[model samples]
Target: MSNFAILITRRQFAITATATSRTVAQRVYVGKPDKISNIRPLAILKNKNDSPLETQLKELQMDTQQWHHKFWMNHNKMFSKSREEFDEKWFAKKQVSSSNQSETTKMLEPEDMAIFHRNFLHNNLEAQRTYDREWKTRNKKLLFLSAQVAFQRFYFKWFKSFFSRKS
Candidate 1:
């Protein structure tokens, strides 16, 4: 009877151990997807009636717009990831040094993000300025090209209408 009891206890222990191991193995961490990785380039629509110059201008405008979108998407994504990493490190350090022994580990809250925001901006001020300058330049170029295309389209339509009315 004693031998049977020992065998039963050993089997139960083996089963429990296997179940625990399976659960532990199944636990996995999944990080958030990168914002920039999801960005799709803007499509350029071309008209069959467009003149060579008009087509070129439209292409240029589309390219500039795509570049602008890509730049901002990549920059913002990097900034967000950097901020997250900083917050994680800060929270981990705080958790280690904090005197409160009963508190649970937690991520930085939304309210706490202001501190990181200010610091990040301060550190990246030069890069921010450069980005702003480049962004404005590209925007101006895009606007000018778009306006030119619109004006050409309007002038062509007006010329056709005037000639057709006379005929």
Candidate 2:
């Protein structure tokens, strides 16, 4: 009975292996060559005789973007530094309190890191909430300002065209 089962298993394995090899062999690429011109690139801003107002607006946009990027970069750096300090302090405390100093001084396991993360988040929850609220308010104001600028530009263009046509 065992020999019969072994024979059946070997036959099934051989069948699956051959089937998979046949499917792989059938998956040859039979498509046309790709065209480089089909790919679309990002828009590049060009200063092609833009008006003074347009230039200033562009500069303002760039400056705000830079400020936003810098803020996030600095925030991330601060968060990382704080996390590292927390980890070090916690590890040191554990090492001092633990009777097995050598074991406690070893690298933190995933579970230990998780507990530290929870504690860190709990400690900074209020500060984090405040930062998030301020960020959201700033972003909302910036968006409104942008919309106002766009509407003003559109209205100015329409007014100029109307007067020009009358003249």
- The most accurate candidate by lDDT is 1
Query: How big is the positional error of residue 129 in model 2, measured in Å on the Cα after superposition?
Result: 1.0
Which regions of candidate 2 are displaced past 4 Å? 1-78, 86-107
Model 1 alpha-carbon miss at residue 166, Å:
1.9
lDDT digits (tens) for residues 74-114 of candidate 2: 55666688777866677676666545545665666788778
Query: 1-167 in candidate 1: lDDT tens per residue?
Result: 01111111343232111111211111112223335655434444555655777677767766765666676777787788886687567757766555542253354566567877887789788877987898788778767876876677667767887999999
Clashes of 2: 0
Number of clashing residue pairs in every model? 0, 0
**lDDT, residue 67, model 2:** 54
* Residue 109, candidate 1: alpha-carbon lDDT: 64
